[model samples]
Target chain A: MPPDAPAHLSEEQIISLVAYLAGGAGGDLAVGIGDDCAVLGGDQTGLVVTTDLLVQGSHFDLELMSPADVGHRSMAANLSDLAAMGARPAYGFLSLGMPARPTAAFVSELVGSMVAQGRAHGLKLAGGDTVKAPQVVINLCLLGAMGNLAPVLRSGGRLGDAVCVTGLLGGSGAGLAWLQAGRDPAEAAAAEAVAAHCRPTPRVAAGRALAESGRVHAMMDLSDGLAADLPRLARASGLGAAVEAEAVPISPAALAVAPALGGDALGWALGGGEDFELLFTCDPGEVPLLAQVVAEAAEGLTVTQVGRLTQGPGVTLIKQGEEEPITYKGFDHFQEPAP
Target chain B: MPPDAPAHLSEEQIISLVAYLAGGAGGDLAVGIGDDCAVLGGDQTGLVVTTDLLVQGSHFDLELMSPADVGHRSMAANLSDLAAMGARPAYGFLSLGMPARPTAAFVSELVGSMVAQGRAHGLKLAGGDTVKAPQVVINLCLLGAMGNLAPVLRSGGRLGDAVCVTGLLGGSGAGLAWLQAGRDPAEAAAAEAVAAHCRPTPRVAAGRALAESGRVHAMMDLSDGLAADLPRLARASGLGAAVEAEAVPISPAALAVAPALGGDALGWALGGGEDFELLFTCDPGEVPLLAQVVAEAAEGLTVTQVGRLTQGPGVTLIKQGEEEPITYKGFDHFQEPAP
Candidate 1:
């Protein structure tokens, strides 16, 4: 850090700085920062908007991921935010910055992947802006609608609510590890892990089903791993949570990569990020209903109850008959080493 | 350009490539790539969204513009797109990429400028993403509402509509020239021109009023100069335009810098970009109403009738009682010399 630079300010500090400067989104903006998506207009006819950026060196590497995968992941990151709000994806705006004039073929491949991913979730590429830059930066903004259901927020969790997560965890993290290790791409397990990291799917239908169930209290996507993101949901709801370590689902691919990486599969499942899966809170009695909703919406997808909300503030992990408080720390852009 | 670099493709070619690869925003997206803002939902209860990117080296220089100015201009660029669609500004999301760890004070200054500018137009800063990058990049996505009127798209102009522009032109272009020449910043004229270039205001009120009048047929903002942007509007509407060169409004500040820069004021007004003013079209009979609406909404701002739509395709400049077909060329990112 330079003499004039701030002392390794955390992501939370930067967010607070922005909040302090911006005050609050009064008037038309119903929900501002701290939520899965910014809510605009009223509940009757509202819009949920979210924006995410994918930097070349920080978020991805050109050597590891194809341009098509980059495009897909960029859109998926933003669409997942809308999914967390249970909003139906509607329109998208992509702003791309390239280091130099890329070939027409490259541009087509990148944009085609975006369009294809968007079409899967009923999203349309409405418009975007392009410019030359020092590196490739893709910023995607997605707009979604509440449809027949009201938008779900991260601040609705209550004490004793069941904390549940969709799909398995740590696959993306293990996949990233495998790719970084330069493992053979021809291996079936390695290929699966890499695909999980490169093209993680957003749980749009599952989110919509959960929202329509009227049982889900709080919801958000697991982008920064369970250890980091669950605390956000807990803090937003003015509560704490106790997650059962044994109940956390570690994918087969993650388990396979754990021994070679010299780390436990459970640790990766706890702290690994970029899963793009939904983590929600619902009434303890509604867990079965939530599972049914997910089963009906997406075949083969499982919703597991891994924890329960508590009245106290802060998250704790119950592992091996012991309780350990979890710290709130995600992938900080400034603090963490560049990928 | 490198042999594989597409030979420095023009901006138009890039746009066409994007259009071809993405196809069109069919189904829910009412208006797509060719318009100023993408329209979602129906005309009555629709949403307008637009995104713009500001690169540190390409769009602004740190030495020339303050952080506040960069923030203000970033919001202004997106707001101007909403204005072009005659929509009321609603919410905004900013995605910022910084080269290194920024100071708290610097972050506050940049975000404060964005909040202040957004507040002026009844817009609010909802949320955003931040990350470290090789250079500063600000990407803003603005969402707006039509508010009792249909969105006035760039393709609404007919064969006989009158072409008009709000405020003066070339001030920003001339300001860039003056700043590049290292003129004394203390001089009133020089300062005013620089301000125009650095902090050009979007004509939100004028745009809203025009849409309310139901007289303006088509609209867009002049960000790429008349010589370039007018052709876009013409091509979108499938009509030609005959612009009266003498009628185009050139700012006094532009005229003052022209001689020093060895350029004609009219040429700068026509070809120079970044004059964030409204360029709209209306029926000849409704021109008076359009002017009245702008006068009532924004005092001291002038709306000048500089051209009329023709039955053919392409833009022609009428000067000295003769018609000169205008070429379709503007600031192409890949082709233009780096600033």
Candidate 2:
């Protein structure tokens, strides 16, 4: 673990680091970490790729984050994008930056976590680069397959489509609020919220099911809260939407903690980021079947109809007796945080 | 661009940024950028990938660097890794951490320059993530193909082979020194040296030739200066080497600027980092064709037989009739800069 000792990097250490991180699923990876470029099994067929970067200080704080969580979240963020496009992940290319004096154990833990998550997602860590830097930065690019299926884009929604979301939201928002308030929650609540923040479960199965149904029009993962992201899908599809306030699904756990946190459960469900849930729209005729399919495919996750796409250009929230335009604002990269 | 700008970006600006960074000489990339995931036109293939992060104040100074140079260098650094492995570049995924309110023209110029340089090297900018941060940080991940060629690894060399280096060195070190001293060089010399510092040329063709020949036993790129990197390659290959100091290819421009910069030109060539030239070793029999093949393959680049891989396990420097043990010291990430 000493900074100067390279001998600590035994064969086991190397294997443990790369076993899950790089290599081909079909055993066609020519070279892995010991060499420079990984030689993959080749045939010019299909490649689906997406890249994302997560900064240490910006995305996650090292002081409060688990190395495994960092690794999991890094891969999860990119995989969520792939899921939204209904792609089956096959391989990944990662580039990492860390301080030179960092413990090999730290690096190993991160890589080990990546390997575990990558395998779970049916992806092989094919190759990546490492360098010493001021911050621990991760740039992960996933290569996946869209076999026989056309990718679903955000521009496919049409008028009369039912806007839907898979699973409950606001858990991540509650967790962030807990952390920000500098007050710790009880064991079960804290664990649930923290896990929501740390390891997001991307709705890959629901996305795939939607893509296969031939009824669902548009789909995207909710990384930036639904209130902000819905408008993006709407704009892309050239349609507006109307959502009943009561229809938005808020988790019981989120509701239980919202009052204590001095934040609204509805607000988090509407605008919480990093939930990694799927927000989609489907034809009204296929609603029942699609909902059933999403429920079954998503391991009991709820598929709730939160809104309906209309032939217009803005989102509106319809409450008990009044309707108001839903401002499309969520997490802004440069905006000051709300007090 | 303002942070609150509309989500819909101008087609011209997007085109200017993305279109120019496409096209490569090797591999079948299925989807290149315009879509969600770039589909490499291949199936179940092994892939080699790497990423690097360049931070402002840590890597370079914005006051002294041009946007184009920043774009070029950030990408060039990652390309150099692929070059060291003799991999043909297919595409790159970029991740930028920019300060909010950055000049749109600056982003455009940086992206444009990256696109232009990518084309020159037969590399395409696939897609990437962008976010706001306090300082500018560029993270680039490259995906390359090695085909069926044997990847020249750092662990394959045997003793008694001729140690070779392609192209001149130490110009970047001298340039940095001159910049630190704040002493201006003659116009041409200043331009050349600074260019060498900012825009390193990765020896891709030479790397491919070295791999294709099946003669070179070991190889690596000189990014951390020869003094530091040669030892790394030797350590990886389980061998030692002896360098004839006079045999190193010194840049005339570097030599002209060294005295004014308060450093030795030879020292820069031996210890200056970021040259991105290839250093390798081959058997005595292969030496006959090494120069010819290198010239034909690398064109304007020069390859020199600088030293010999020895039976021992350490590096030795031989100058004139005198010999001394080489320290293998250069830019140590852990150590503070020379006082």
Candidate 3:
């Protein structure tokens, strides 16, 4: 049978399902989502193109999500892809499907949030489409520039390069647990989790800074959790990696909230999704300078050296002086396992 | 409540909804709509973006349509938009939501038909997303280039210009009637009507020809049938039009089949929809030259001067020896009186 929704979910509820499934607009877009079409500004190195699809019941929960939050998330997802390629976003295209008669205000809120976010990041809203469907589906396309330099690819990480990440991780998974467990954590913690999920700040500045440093070997964003994404990066680079489990930074609030959900903060940090942080590999000698420059350039973002690339072809996770082989698996739309 | 569907309709039967919406992969699209994201092949003019949405039971009917035809028609609908603006079909991005496990092959055929049409016009299938939904929905974003020339706006037509059209009209409306009657005409006529419905060819080359000829004043594709669309062009261009009913070329086959279908051939020719033909205006002196060149360039296509632009506003129809206003209205998704 076709998926059945409530006879009448408020327009806001429907908007919440599709809006933040991708982040809203940014400064790069000239037109954004509300117009008949999005116009992209001209730039050097042509336009960087990328798209992603988010599915309801797979990528988000309408019951626990807000329309504004969904709007923010949709743009953020596309932005993260731009950040990974070391491209500065200029505009985006959004295509959404949901129930008919969704509130105009709800759609406006979603578009407004996207525009606000685009302005914050110097991205622009270019164009997109909207239609009625059973469940919510979102497709986001971002146009960016290669800037004055080349993009950092997953295949660029080299042996002996220091692997690192910007900012904390696991907060989103921990937050999700809190929501799922029926426990109302402190308002601050709840806010942090929701922020992580809804407004993941793509490391555009950090990525640009790292790309300019000329010392970084490769780069990517941490979205499908580290354990799943890191190995892909390593494999693409034709190398293996040894990660120090303890070196991975976890959100303090996530740590505090983990016990109540019967999960480990480390697991959340290593495997949590929706953490739109940068994970890059640089020369070990460049770590100190890299940290200082990245910190200054990215504001509150914290750069941490967490691992080292090796000659072999597998991931090794070090914990309490013991070594365990780490398997990499992230979110897959048609995959059987969520991890 | 949502619209009802015929019983015994399988999930695949429903997913045929978005089967045809092809996005324009403008001049610089590297990729679009079937992959991770649409890669823009950025150009000097940047990107001219446009999007449109089609919903099941709203824009089309599954009971009266084949999946492949639905798919082809939907894409043709959006391609018509790009043609209206004289944009080169470059790349397409699609976002579709439908009941899952729909025959993959059928989906492939629908998409393949799109790819075939795009290939015929030098476009690429970039990227898009698919998900499960009760009602099938299609969202198409077509990216094309403005070339070095500014886009020919809908409001560019002027007085005293000759209004011309490429190809005949009303075949799609006739095709719809045949489908409703549960009868498929002869293979030849069926092919013509089906082509009108399934793969209405967007007049990209013809539009570009008009735009580049330096003779055309304004242009738009006939989508909502000539009766409704002519006024839109006239309104946009701040001019009036006098369409000659006898001059409006009607297909001989459409005329032959009209009596049998208990319909007027003139009505279908004037008010039918989905003829993706270019309706352009040019100086009266340029009409002869344009007709010759467009005919030669768009081989197998006929270009005819069917009307004349007037100083005042609105549209008037002139029939043989009797020049009077014809109150001809075409299809409107929202304006259609409820059944």
Candidate 4:
């Protein structure tokens, strides 16, 4: 679930649920689901892994996607997590369940795109399992190497670190809005927004560059909207956050589409998740250098400071000098409308 | 898809389809989908990983299984794959899609069981993704360490190598037979078979032991039964295999229920998959020593030599001095009646 799953079974809940299982495991396991990717400790300390599932009619609408787009988006979701950890992508395993038997061509295109995505991201589509189900389900696991590199974890942020996000937000949400409204991208002004929602690019290069910069304190990808995801980063770091409402970078595409769809761009940027951009915290003085490094590493990318990790215990929003507790919750992507 | 899917889409096909993408990738990739697990190469050469998917009504029956059993069985499937490679289990990532909202107890039991199963197998349930779908879907990806352990590849067998398997076959299939026939184990004489079907064990300890013995040449688990799985091992080794029909070990439970079900125990042992037995080849002279090692390593486990790798081009079965090509196919666990 992404944001408003009702069952906000967040990483915190999952950890609490599995607390009984974590009591000393021969010292092999380190972190669980609280991080962007699981960090293997002790003997496997330098390895990080993550898995994400996409269900047809739940995470994606097959009607609006080409097989390639589905593959790309699914791959991107996992890749983004690995990126957040500053891990170098290595191997990928995919398991798929297709309820309907399309032509061999359809299967080929679908799988080919996955292979292409893996190759594009330096990930090898190494092994996978295929089964039958009631709908199209894709499960992807990526194993990455953090060897010889420092992992930027979500818990490392300092109370006074500047919270930053790379790239604009709300575009993906607006694209989804356009889609849900039955406006085809080809025939709608929200085509850019739809593309943003559909073809998310994992910030592998920028993440790696940021990690290498050694200035980043904590990092994660904004998949569940900035409003909900920022609090998670703050909580993970054992701190709170204060965001300037005006500092939230709304996407141009979202701005253009919101008026047409009668949607609020600010709300979408704050609460309409699915923007696969890197969110990090760093020393205030290093912000400019961090932005420059990411922009140079990955073309056309920008880093914006939206807030600061605060000493307080709850996230607050600064609107015209008024501080208000954040109340925006995101829908669980797993339970959400199709991307 | 498993053995008898009209569309086998075997690893060979999967590899062939991606050959274009595998041509040159900065020398990072070493292998693809043709083995029990993908062999990571280059900087991460000491690792092996595998993934498997289980779907409701396709791979398992909820009515016949407790959530714990489902979790264990799913874990066993992937563990068996890692075991085949002589890999040490490290981390596991799970992806689940639940169609209906079961009670909170159901969810806890399901996840807790997965955690328990991972703990029992020295695996850490590190991360996972959850979603809502029209039917239950489970995908597990396990990453293992081959460090300091020589991985037993399916292609390592030499001509005249003894073909062997761990434990009995056909019991799981018989168990499935009972379940599909609506015979509850509480009042059934095939209770052991039902137990076998519901709680198939992966031969991890024995597999690792075999790899340590350094005598076993090629290896794989019989997830798709002996008849179908043996040929895969043979093909991978660039050789053929010949099995003695009378030597194929049939489980006592399978034997006891075959007559009751009017089933041919031999046929089930050969083709009715889901046995989860490790099948391997070794130097004929090392059979006794290899068997003893595994027996010592994994109590109550036994390895038996059924035949030998041959120099021919295909698999053959000899019954009473007559040789015949094997034609008994297995239903893909991903396609057939639930296990």
Backbone-clash count (model 4): 10
Model 3 scores a TM of 0.79
User: Alpha-carbon error at B90 in model 4, in Å?
Assistant: 1.4
Worst 10 residues of 4 chain A by lDDT: A1-10
- Candidate 4 per-residue lDDT, tens place, B284-330, comes to 99999998998998896988899999997889999999999988765
Better of 1 and 4 by TM-score: 1
Give per-residue CA lDDT, model 3, range A71-189, as digits (tens).
77877877877777677776666666555445444555555676567657766554555555455666676766765666777778988999999999988877777776766544665
Candidate 3 lDDT over residue span B1-339, tens digit each:
113433322222222211112223344443333221233344324346566666677667777776666767777766766766667776665666554334444455455565566657755545455544455666666666656655566667888888888888877777777666777645565557655665677777777676677777777777768887788778768888999888988866467567767877778778876787888888888887888777766786788888988986678888776766657765433223321
> Comparing 3 and 4 by TM-score, which wins?
4
Question: TM-score of chain B, candidate 3?
Answer: 0.82
Q: What is the lDDT of residue B217 in candidate 1?
A: 84
TM-scores, in order shown? 0.95, 0.81, 0.79, 0.93
lDDT of candidate 3 at residue B100, scale 0 to 100: 38
Compute the lDDT of residue A40 as modeled in candidate 2.
27
Best candidate, DockQ: 1
Query: For model 1, how does the per-residue alpha-carbon lDDT over A99-158 read when each residue is reduced to its tens digit?
Result: 656777667768889888988997878888888777788999988888667899999999
Error of 4 at A267 (Å): 1.4
Give the DockQ of candidate 1: 0.51
lDDT tens digits by residue: candidate 1, B96-211: 88866677766776888988999899787888888887778899988888866789988888998899999999888888888777776557756767788888899999899988
Model 2 residue B187 lDDT? 62
